[model samples]
Target chain A: MNFAQPVYYPKADYIETDTGNKVSRRATIAGPQNIILGGKTIISSTAIIRGDLRRTGPGHAVVISLGKYCLISEGCILRPPYKTYRGNFNYYPMKIGDHVHIGANTVVEAAMIGNYVEIGKNCIIGKFTMIKDCAKIADNTVIPPNTVVPALVLFSGSPGQFVENLPESTQELFESQTKQYYNRFQPLEG
Target chain B: MAPIKDRFTIHSKAVVCQDVDLRGEITIGSGTVVHPKATIFAITGPIVIGANCIIEEAVIIINRKKEVMRIGDENLFEIGCRVECPSIGDFNTISTRARVHYTLRLTSYCVIGAGCLVVLPEEEVLEEHTVIYGPASERRVWSGRGHIQELDLRRKHSEYLRETLPKFNRLRRGDGA
Candidate 1:
């Protein structure tokens, strides 16, 4: 196999490292390992990213792949391999695409998340849930497991029902706004 | 202290910090705070409380079999209120010692007076600041339309003054406005 030069730290943004001691910052990180924070993503105070690959099976290890310019707010739990109802199998790795905004107190244990997704406060996204790109989930929503959310759709309510689809221009605006959030993270705030 | 039965199954995401007594299939939403000594039982149907609600102390939220109870967010069920209503809207307030029974639904921002009886004699809407003093004499207003029992000497004088100008209505109307 011919050797190709590896691209080191591809994305430009802020990223905070949380190994054991907390290095909370609004930054992004890039890597193939577990808990790959997109270069320049802000992980707020007391935010725990349990990106241990050993929890999942070997080779297909677990990872919290947060995309570029994503803001995971305070007190949010983004567990990639979450426990299932059967009490045996855990869910797969969580894939959060670029420009996603996750509010406070949201517990998301899902397999995939699309780009420009905005999840409001106090929402509990069940395990193995697949959120389509540009979808909006309102506050206080409880999205059950195994849900296949469509693109540009609005999710609201207790069990969460499809409200309406967002326009393309609005989706673009939402996606572009998170870059400013990534830039605002000052390491001195610690 | 009573026996702790495994009736309610709270999700791991729910933040239930205080010690409260709950029975039957009660699903408390995320960020809901059930204060200490608040007892809730869904003996008949399920009691579903939405997120960000505060159930204060000594409040009992019970639902009989075949009847479901739903509560919206940011509601405060004050101390010692006995609520058996089927549904209550968001941002509502239930005052202390109020007896709510057979209530079909209470809309948002509605207020129940203290020591009052909020019930459906035959499914009626008791709008904001609705009050009822005596048992079985649940009148819409303090007029002689519904069962108005005679009061004692001091209470009769107070009743006369109440008929002229319901001061609580004036004060509570200020609250509603």
Candidate 2:
């Protein structure tokens, strides 16, 4: 009940998945049965994962699948894409590859994100977009739906478009940062 | 949704959703519909919302002043709008994703457009029917419908919301709903 001396973790701050992923206690993880988080992934507090928004009548249908060492920051929302097909609203799967980091308050409904992608804060990744590997999306960018972001490019703006090609070392940076974030994300102890 | 918090004074007719996070002294008037994930923090000062207000999903109203953050009747805060103002008058519509900073006095019939950030330190009052749109707080002349019309629309929406939302979340007069 006290604010001071807050450096204490009574239990674990996050629940460790069988694959070594960590999901914060404060994060809203709905219908976890539909979500597949790879090992070493970190989902921060206040993030919302709408795993319940999966395709209806599903067996082995993964609504949201995050690869290993991915980081989802605070207030981000990860929702599968929904579309009206054949007179009914159907949700599609969302897939993210390894070593990807989505920044704070970003909302991602993208169909696919390749490995080593880094999205900055306050981005709105439009539904059904295809983001290739080693891509970097800057803060406050809004990518239009169905837009394809080619590999190793930087995108930034209200409606996100290609800004420049990413450094060849972009993958290395993401790998290091993902591991660093995973290690730093721990329950406080007093 | 988090558990029903303590120290909240909600009217019997107020419809607060399941996931609202309240911390300090907060009060809501009758016929107000607060949707899921709406956060009302009154740690520094009390926040009193007037009647027939519709607070949509993820709307955050915080009071960070020495005085009470008084909100008047028929205010409609759309999805993801952040209100940290000292006082907001009647019939104000804060559109989606707009941020109203601390101590700004929003008068009646002001429409804050989507994604706008309003943080004018000098201007205390957003005069009658003024609209703030765009990320740079571009002040534009207000037009179209009157405040009465706006208030009626919001009230009707709130009425509809009360019936539909109660099906999902338990509603009570007290704080612990």
Which candidate ranks first by TM-score, i.e. highest?
2
lDDT of each: 0.61, 0.79
Model 1 chain B lowest lDDT segment of ten = B167-176
The DockQ of each candidate is 0.02, 0.07
TM-score of 1: 0.44
Estimate the TM-score for candidate 2: 0.63
lDDT of 2 by residue, A74-143 (tens): 8987877655556444668999999999999887889999999999998877679899999999999867
Error of 2 at A32 (Å): 3.0
Q: TM-score for each prediction?
A: 0.44, 0.63
Model 1: lDDT equals 0.61
Give each candidate's interface RMSD in Å: 28.3, 6.9
